[model samples]
Target: MTRALISVFDKTGIVDLARAIANAGIDIISTGATARVLAEAGIAVSGVESVTGFPECFDGRVKTLHPLVHGGILADRRKPDHVAQMKELGVEPIDIVIVNLYPFEETLASGASPDECIEQIDIGGPAMVRAAAKNHASVAVLTSPSQYGDAIVALERGGFTEEERRVLAARAYAHTAAYDAAVANWMTELADEEPQYVGVGLPRTATLRYGENPHQSAWLSADGKGGVANAVQLGGKEMSYNNYRDTDAALRAAYDHLDPTVAIIKHTNPCGIATADTIEQAHASAHACDPVSAYGGVIAANRKVTRAMAEQVKPIFTEVIVAPDYDEDALELLQTKKNLRILKVTPSEEQRDITQISGGFLVQARDQVDQAGDVFAGWDHVAGPEADEQTRNDLEFAWRTVRSVRSNAVLLVKDGASVGVGMGQVNRVDSCRLSVERANTLGVAVESDVDTAGGAQAGTAASEERARGSVAASDAFFPFADGLEVLIEAGVKAVVQPGGSIRDAEVIEAANAAGVTMYFTGVRHFAH
Candidate 1:
């Protein structure tokens, strides 16, 4: 009779699986808790010691490590010599091995002690799983409770097919691989050492329609703890690849502020970001920054979506809206837009940032803007006179907002809202020019006497007037004085940036000449 060995930390469907195996005339062998549970459920099961002939020692860690248990699972039934050795060793070939590892991740998340966490790591379970998976030609290994249903049907029909066994073997390897990765990462964190080798194992949670384009295939994989990847969709059509990217961008931008804030994102870059006293006011202000670009954009709010906010967004052609939650009236209103994707996302704790390169991955700690409390506390005012309270506040807002923009980024802020944003440029000068142009062309007028002409020169005076007192932020230092000149000429009153460029003296001199207050943060935020 065929025999199956079962051991699992999670006993979700073990009894039902064991009953099916017993009814199929297959003998069941289980370890410690699993055996006790099966016996209590009225299933005739033999302890693993019955086959290994050695009692479990080391607090039950040594039970399944014996050669008898491994030999049975590893033996190749097609090889005459392997079968002969198993017979001579009095080992019964175990056709199925069902095992799941201990809950190391759960233990870590629960704030367990080091000793407790180490004790939860399974040593023998992964060993048995690897052995059975290697000899899948003769043995089938199941690692998840979800796999039990299919395994039971296959066992009831005599046995699993070769293809089925191969698939199970592949899943078994992935299961062990992910478990090992979690353990390794945890140990590295405990030791407080930079890992020489990093392992990442994210399970696929979704299959997207395509990649950045329609022809390329794409899928979404995540750790599933929290964040945009695991956000709950409440309404709208299925999300596409671009939708997830833009929504994540919007969420990050919105959450970076302390007040009620909204960020409108397009192509993973923020078109507008603003913080206000209410969600509705914030959304209106942010949308006013670039009304044309806000169409079909993704919007994220740090606060719950209120009915007033929903009413403001209803008429726009928005692609997605992500927030922590939604008021009943707000959700009901937004759901009317059937094709607009609505997501409820709870922010997860910050994690390491990993990017894939040609040969391998580049892993680094997240460049959090708030890692240092009060980003402006250490800034040096190197040029012009001291800024007024309002100008200083706008400078701080621009500095924080610029961190989320792409490289060669420059942002203009007035009254806690972005007036103009220029990003993804090849040079700082162009970004400066673009930001000034956008401020004059698309930004809301600071005065009522704004020129109404549609041409480039129509609002030249009013555009300069609007930018007169606004503060600007640069993601990095200006390599030359030309970038600063552009902002100063456009009427920017103050600026904030990291100041380590080779031509820092020239840039500072330009600011001083223009009487524009300039502060150096000594830190750069470069988002590629």
Candidate 2:
């Protein structure tokens, strides 16, 4: 009779598979829990001890370490020498080995002690699996419970096809791969070694609808449920991949607001960000920053999204809106947008950042928040027009937003609203030029008096015609005065930035000479 051995950690399909194999007149040889489970299910079985004529030893670690198990699994069916050797050793030919390793991933995640995790590692199981997979052309290998049914079906059909065998062989390797990676990760964490097992245990969160656009495929990586994954839906529809990306940006910007704030993001950049006495005021300021970009953007309120807030937001074309809580009417009003994704989540505390490597994971706490006051190793330009209370607060706000942006980033915020954002440039100067260019191209020439009477949905040039005055934000300390000169030429009248460069006096002198107001936030936010 053909024979198979079965053992598994994830017993997803063991009982039915064991029955099917037994019904095909195959002897089922198992060890310990595998045998007990089979016997309880009323299936006939041969225990490893009985087959090998040796009892399990060393706290069951030595259960399957016998010639009977290895000889049968490793024997090459086409080689007369191998078959003769197995017969000479009184070993019954084992046609299949279905085994899975211990739950090391689960144990590690459970905060298990080192000893507990070490004990859960499976040695004999991997050995048997490797042996069976190596001889897969003649013997079937089933390293996972998920593959049990397929293995039995092939046997019942008389023999496994070459393609079928190769597919199972590949999966067997993957099973071993995931198993080894888990153990390595836990040990690495215990050793406190950076990159010890980076990229090891992170699971793919989902295959998104598409990446930045419809052509590219994308997936999300998140700690399952309660982290980024468990944000609630207060209203609207499912988020596409791009929506998640932009919403995360908005959340980070909202968090940077030291006061109760609101932020709106489009395509992973801040179009609007503000802090104020209420969510409504903050939202309005943020919206005014770039009302054109605010359309179909993601908005996040640091506090609860209120009814009044919802009423004001209802008129815009928003893609997603997030907050901690929503009043009854607030939720109802938002529900009207069939495709607007509404998420309720605690504003993310600046505490977690995840990095994945080729074979493991690297986790770290968020870098400290850099607030604007005097964040430099050396504060430059002090007492050179101490920032007005409004400029000072705006300085802090600008610093927070700048840090969340890409390196070589610059933002322009005026009257508490983020007006222009320039990111991902080649250098600080390039970023400065880009910010000024963006403002001039979009909202640079203040036209605050442009007629909104034509309706809020009015055209862009007309809208830019309405905004008056210019303000700017930079992500890092200015290395020289030229960057400030560029902004002034572009019509910017105020500046906010982390002022740590040694030449702050030069930049300050230049700004003062030009009659432009500037503030030092003293901190920097660099996402890279």
Candidate 3:
């Protein structure tokens, strides 16, 4: 009878697969819990201990590594010498090997002691998988319970061909490689060195139908180390390759702020970001920032999604909504929009900043997030140049947004609201122009939305009221007054930024000259 060896951590469909194998007249061999599960189901299973004559010792760590198991899996039926050796060794060839490795990723993520994580690493299982996979021309290898049904079905229909086994073999190697990578990553992380670079670590979670385009294919892998940024599937249809890229960018922008914030992003650039008294307020401000650009954009928030915010979001057309969490009410509201992909990525313990260069990986510390606190430590705002509490709050938010934006960036903000932005330009003045144009396009009040909303109640000059709702911020020091000059003309009343240009006095003088208030946080935030 053909022999099948099964050892797995994820017992998703083990019993049924074991039963099917038995019905197909194949001898089932399993180790530890897998053996118990199969035996309990009245499916005959030969334990690895019995076959190898080596009792599972060291609390079950030393199982399935004996010559019997390896000799069975590594034997080639087509090779007369190998077949003869297997018979002489009294080893029945393992025609099929089904194995899933230990939870190395899970153990590392559990905030467990180092010893605990080390203990979870399965040496024997991976060895058998590789042995069976290496001889794919004569053996079938199954590593996941998810693939068990398919493998059993293939075996039932006159067994897996060389091509089928090769596919499983290739996946098995990738699985072991990815598993080893995660363990190596965690071990290396215990060291304290940023100058030295290591490698990336992740396990394949799923394979997408295609890549960014239909012609290409791709897989969704997760850094199994659990934390806020671990692999997460919030909700939505199968994510296309484009949606993941755009959604990731949006999450980066959204998480930039320590405060409750929201950013509407399109094609990797942020179209709007706002910090309001509440998340709802931030969303309204962010939505008004570039209402036109936000259509079909990806939205990300720093805080958990609340019902009120979700209600407001339901009215808009968006491709994806990403946040740390979604409240029951919010999730209920969002569920109605079945096509909108929801992504909930909490900060994960295992996070690596990775960049692909040439043919390898460039890994670095996650670019740190700096909080905009005490930045203006002892300096008065150059006398007569100061910001109020509300203005300062908005000022800090604007400063952070500028750093995340493309160079030659301009960010417009006010009262915790983002009005307009112009980014990725060759000249600062062009950024200013784009900011004003986008703000205008969004119908953000040239002055103040608060006044417009209030003035509408009082039957006053709504046009003037609306325009007062905006402010402008710059990413770098203003090299000249030209950029601020352009912004001031666009009806930006207050400006906030890092004050460190060669012509700092010149820019300050220009602000004072233009009768606008300017406050310097005394620090520059530039992200490249």
Question: Which candidate do you rate higher for lDDT, 1 or 2?
Answer: 1
Q: What is the C-alpha RMSD of each candidate to the true structure, in Å?
A: 3.8, 5.6, 4.3
Which stretches of model 1 miss by more than 4 angstroms?
Answer: 445-465
**Model 2 C-alpha lDDT per residue in residues 355-441, reported as the tens digit of each score:** 768896567767566643444233343433655666665555666667667777888766666666778877777877876655555
Q: Candidate 2: lDDT over CA atoms?
A: 0.73
Q: Can you write out model 3's per-residue Cα lDDT over 1-528, one digit (the tens) per residue?
A: 389998888998989888888888899888889999888889999888889888889988899888898999888888899889887889888888888988987777677899999998889988988998899999888888768878778867868877888999999998888777767766776765543546444556778789978889888775644332353666678777677777777777777777788888887778778776567667766776665677888888989899878877877788988888889889989989988888777754324567778988766556443444554453337412466677666666777677667777888876666667788888888888888776665534322323223221222221232325466778777888888888877777778776778888888888788778887656555544
Rank list by TM-score:
1, 3, 2
Q: Which ten residues in a row have the lowest lDDT in candidate 2?
A: 450-459
Model 1, 422-442: lDDT tens digits are 899999999999888888777
Best of the two (1, 3) by TM-score: 1
Error of 2 at 350 (Å): 11
**For this target, which candidate reaches the highest lDDT against the unseen true structure?**
1
TM-score of each predicted structure versus truth: 0.93, 0.74, 0.84
Error of 1 at 481 (Å): 1.4
